[model samples]
Target: MENKIINFGAGPAKLPEEVLKEVQKNLIDYEGTGLSVMEMSHRSAGYFKINEDAMNDLRELVGVPSNYKILFMQGGGTGMFSAVCLNLMGRTGTADYLVTGSWSAKAAKEATQYGSVNLILPKVQKYTSVPRQSTWSLDPNASYVYYCDNETVDGVEFDFVPETKDVPLVCDMSSNFLSRPIDVSKFGVIFAGAQKNVGTAGITVVIVREDLLGKPMKITPSILDFTITEKNNSIYNTPPTFIVHVMSLVFKWIKRNGGLQGMYNNSLVKSKLIYDIIDKSNGFYACPVDKNVRSRMNVPFRIGCASGHEDLETEFLKLCESKHLIQLKGHRSVGGIRASLYNAMTIAETQILADLMESFFGNKKR
Candidate 1:
């Protein structure tokens, strides 16, 4: 098979080739409709069906309950950093956040500007382990307990859902959404940037519990208000038409790939290959995050090689680039190599990467 660039970039990331092929087929004439999905009116029947199908497929993929509203809103996850705070903070006096890494910290920081914010920082002995829940100081009266679910920067993920009651749970699942199955019932709100698993940038999907609507503070912008968006079906404005169209293709791609079960199994295989290589590589490579909280979606590893080769990641990335492997660099906040194995990543591509890692380290040992 042709091993073109293996795009492991996180967000604005790679998409399934099938999805792209489908888009290409329909780009000029979408299902006999007169216009491209982009050119069609957002309120038009054809376009509305595209929107509806996308939401329905998402609902099926995540097992979203009937009571939840799947909203396709503009702005990335950063927008919801304020939107969630605005809509939910009025219900209770304060908002609580779990600071797993940079994203959660920012979510908390933004929320603090609106209401009393409590930030929960995990107790880390090193960059290697996640703090147990017992170690976390959680507040009972907080409006909603917010967490990143998966930290894209630090490569840390909550292996299991946190146990809380009588409070709504909100999660920013940007990087890892649809990477696997999640218990959607546990969250009062789940928002993700489409750039990651959803499809592209410019659109954010917000899944909010029905009851949580209509509680927006008066200061909340009418567009940012959850109640208003829900009422208008997430089309208060023109909406991100082009992005939504691409997202529909992605949603259809997920369904065609055996739905969630296929995605779950594929993720397990891809993640296990990389993690096992890291574990078995005899300390030549290291995964910093604790194994328990390891993010299967984003695998960040450090390479230890001698002779100015210590900065081997730069060279490794270059090598991968030569072989058409793309975007293997880690985030700036946590410097190293991060391989984002989102749902679109195929097992064959990951195996190619695994072989590259092995060969790279084997040569280093020589």
Candidate 2:
């Protein structure tokens, strides 16, 4: 455990160490089934139990209401771009999208093909702060009001839920899922890609309020249809059994550690440690995000002010890699350095990063 290298990648991020070890131990034979979960039939008893427990455990972990149906879907969060619009657009001819960052912007653009999409906030060149919601023009008659709870690339997060009044509030929580607790009843549909904080790639966790189901555009793919997938128990076809199995283990790990609140507390601790380095570094390091709306999950910063000191930033990344800390590079759309502190990242590992920033930049060692 002490020897494992720390990972700070955004998606396909680090999972709990214990979960990995348990999977490694059970890879050959699962519960005496004599077959690995990946090799078993989705319809088999082993797979059925795996699927059932995943749903129930997740419901309990998040306190999902009896009226909400938890469904594990595929095609990632991007797939849901179409799934969300197709399923809900039929309720009304339009929807309202609050575009704060890259993900929400993409979602809003996708909705245009299905019906009218009213972007409450126009796109910005650099998303540094979430504009006050008071400036937003929400359409009460729209089918849904959509937003991304956290934007991984922009390092922006909404500290409060947007009130949609009678209209349903839909959210894309792919990057920040499982890192904090949310009121499940407040959202009409909350979907997240599992790779960021829980489980792994290829499966998306979608919690939908029961009343929002059954409406799909005629072109909605059978696999992506929420109503069909839910009715068939997320086994409308061959499901990602291995990912679901891994997710079940991760949920148990979260519950054992301290549930969602515990994860939230840890996130605050980890992110604060790194942000402190940035905050106290003077001009050597800087974070562009508004302190209040800064993401506790993905922290994007620069080595030098304004556009960043490119040469120094390179040296800083090299120092990180040489010390066995990796995936610190920022997204191509916006270049700098990004540290994604997901649920599985340890404070000790985060302290290593914080220490590196202090020693490298604070001392002008470069």
Candidate 3:
């Protein structure tokens, strides 16, 4: 197989090459069924096994407790913004949201339509670091406390999970899901769009505590109701069959590669390779995020001077592409460069990027 350009996009990011190879091998005829897994019926036994194995593998990987119901839903994390509000906000008419970055802010905005949203932390000009938990004015009467585990666009991650006391802690782990080990028992609802570290787009993995189900608002759609979806085992209607199959393969790959701990270890090494380069480049490479809250999944940095360096940033991106490194461009909201070192991104690939950055800065200095 020819070498492919490294992918560093935030979502729909790179899949393990071995998993892709397995999919290619089975794309034409899956397990001698003479039909692609995508072409197979969702109700078929083969597909049932696939879905079951995926869920079981995920549970094993994350050490999810027996009380949590893992539901593979259709909508992305954006959809969960409302579903979480509708389903879980009935306990209290208000939900407290920690606005750490773009996704969490959007989620808080979406929740306002279903219930009142209390911003636990004041809005900031840039999401550089998570606010101290002590400073947050969390509502004890709120239904759930929502926060993003990792801010994809801003590249800020929580060094410690927020403690909400009696309030259920709801987390959107979209960008950094499966990149590290998490205490599943602490969260009431943990949802992630599969496009990131899991598989592809079209499926969302939702792990909700059993107590959180059966409590949607009166106007909640049947599809968005966790009770109904969990009762049917995430197949009340036609599911994202192909995406689930791919995700099953991803689960297997994660297990083969040593589960969550292994992924976490690799994440540290890969992220450090780039962060080390940025820190050692004097002032050439600048990371806006606080050192303590820097994300291991996404590293967003700027080239050249901090201000009025668009030309240098553009030239840096072009040079990266020429070296077969792609998707290094940052999100439009915070324009610069973002290197998403997902689970599939190898140390070798990260080294190439670090070398590229060093060379680019060396050349610019000359």
lDDT of each: 0.85, 0.92, 0.91
lDDT of 1 by residue, 1-366 (tens): 456777999878998898888888988889897678778888888878888888888898889999999999886889999999899999777987877777887788888889998867643433445567888778888899998888887788888887778789999999888878888898899999998888988999999999999888989998799899889887788987878989988988888887777887998899999999889877778887778888888898888721113368888888888888888887876677899999999999999999988898789789
Query: lDDT by residue for model 2 over 1-366, one digit each (tens)?
Result: 345688999989999999999999899999888999989999998899999999999999999999999999999999999999999988888999999898998899888999999989867788888888798889989999999999999999998998888999999999998888899989999999999998899999999998989888889999999999999999999998999999999999999999999999999999999999888877678888999999999999988775788898998899888888989999999999999999999998999899888888757944
Q: Kindly give the number of clashing pairs for every candidate.
A: 2, 0, 0
Better of 1 and 2 by TM-score: 2
Ranking by lDDT: 2, 3, 1
Q: What TM-score, computed on C-alpha atoms, does each candidate reach?
A: 0.95, 0.98, 0.98
Question: Which pairs of residues collide in model 3?
Answer: none
Deviation of model 1 at 16, angstroms: 0.5
Worst lDDT 10-window in candidate 2 = 357-366
Q: How close is candidate 3 to the true structure, as a TM-score?
A: 0.98
Between prediction 2 and prediction 3, the one with superior lDDT is 2
Question: Per-residue alpha-carbon lDDT of model 3 for 63-148, expressed as tens digits?
Answer: 99999999999879999998999899999899999998999999999999988899988878888988798787888999999999
